[model samples]
Target: MKWIPQEVETYLSAKEYVDTAVIPVYSLSFGEEMKQSAAAFEFISLLTGYLEKQFTGRILLFPPYTYLKSEHIENVVSGLSKWEETVVQNEFKHIFYITSELDLRMFENKVDGSLIWLPSLPLGNMNEPQKIEVVESQAKQLLSIFTQKWSNHE
Candidate 1:
């Protein structure tokens, strides 16, 4: 399920079955560096779409959390950690923060949930086949991590 109206309703109706929240983090830059910023969002947007579709029932894909590229990352990390605390109290035992922004790893230990980082990919120019290839590769890694997490929790 995603952050859409109907899905959110469904999620609310059955919160127990949907114990995982998949949040995507992106960075926005102003001016000359805007191109890279856009690409970063597009990359995670594509990847998140794929993951959400495959694991809709067990996962809720939240809206992208975008921060200014120039802002201090520690502050962002602190904010995100606080947000995770709220979600944790809501019964989401497994919170997965997935992103293409490598800088986010700085506070991975501080966050109360698992963080999955995939190398940034340029999704703007890719053809259909190329996009599928890239998403599949990244999804393979995610599947492994999720499998391990679920099995261990059980």
Candidate 2:
């Protein structure tokens, strides 16, 4: 499931089964690191989309949580904490924050949700088939992580 209206309707009717939320964190930049930031966005967007399709009714793929690369880490964490509060209040049992920004790892424990840090894979040059293959492979690896968390909670 996704955040779109149609999916929201489906999710509303089956909220009990859709207990997980996946948020992709993006670091936007406009300077020398612009290209790197774009690459991270592309990789994470694709990966999360693939993951959502694999578990459509079980997970809701929220929009990307984007922050400027130059922003303070503390501020970033603070903002995400607010999101967590809202998500929990809305009955999501599990929340996963996926990102390629390594710096976020240092503050993972500060957030209630699981924080996943995946190094950005440059997909700008890959052909469509190659992109799908790479994204699928990464999504496959994430499947176990999500399932394990779900099992533990249950």
Candidate 3:
């Protein structure tokens, strides 16, 4: 059997139904005479659906790229809030989140010890384990910075 995380395992084995969000991104604009390419849109839909099935409907948040307008970028500060509302309505404990620092403020927040940052890569072509080790070490050092603040409140 595979060693799945507690949350992921529970989500996968759950008897109740779950809700999911299908979101995607693009590398170009739609109105600049470069009409939204069918290829991009199809790729997004396919990946989002695949991820949703794999996570068993625990994922709710998605970057607004498939259909995001210019105004949506300004609303990112409240992005988590919107996700929480969706989670509440759906009553799910597992949320599979996928995004980048460009959207998640990766350098700004302290990650929970349970989390990991995975850079985009072709794992089969490189030393993926070593890369993960390096990233994990950095995560530990970064997380330590906030530990002091948290300890003081105890």
Which is better, 1 or 2, measured by lDDT?
2
Q: Residue by residue across 36-125, what tens digits does model 3's lDDT show? A: 344334333333444444444434324543324353543543554455456546554333333322443442243211122223332233
Per-candidate local distance difference test: 0.87, 0.95, 0.39
Better of 1 and 3 by lDDT: 1
**Candidate 1 worst ten-residue window by lDDT:** 98-107
Q: Write the per-residue lDDT of candidate 1 for residues 1-154, one digit (tens) a residue.
A: 9999999999999999998889999888879978888887877888888888988899999988778878899988988888898889999989888887778887799897898887788877999899888988888789889879988897
> Given candidate 3, what's the lDDT at residue 154?
39
C-alpha-based local distance difference test score of model 2: 0.95
Q: Ranking under TM-score, best-scoring first? A: 2, 1, 3
**TM-score for predicted model 1 compared with the true structure:** 0.94
Clashes of each: 1, 1, 0
Instruction: List ranges where model 3 is wrong by over 4 Å.
Output: 1-28, 33-40, 55-69, 77-80, 99-154
Q: What does candidate 2 score on TM?
A: 0.98
**Model 2 Cα lDDT, one tens digit per residue, 29-123:** 99899999999999999999999999999999999999998999999999999999999999999999999999899999999999988889889
- Candidate 3: worst-modelled 10 consecutive residues by lDDT: 111-120
Ranking by lDDT: 2, 1, 3
TM-score of each: 0.94, 0.98, 0.37
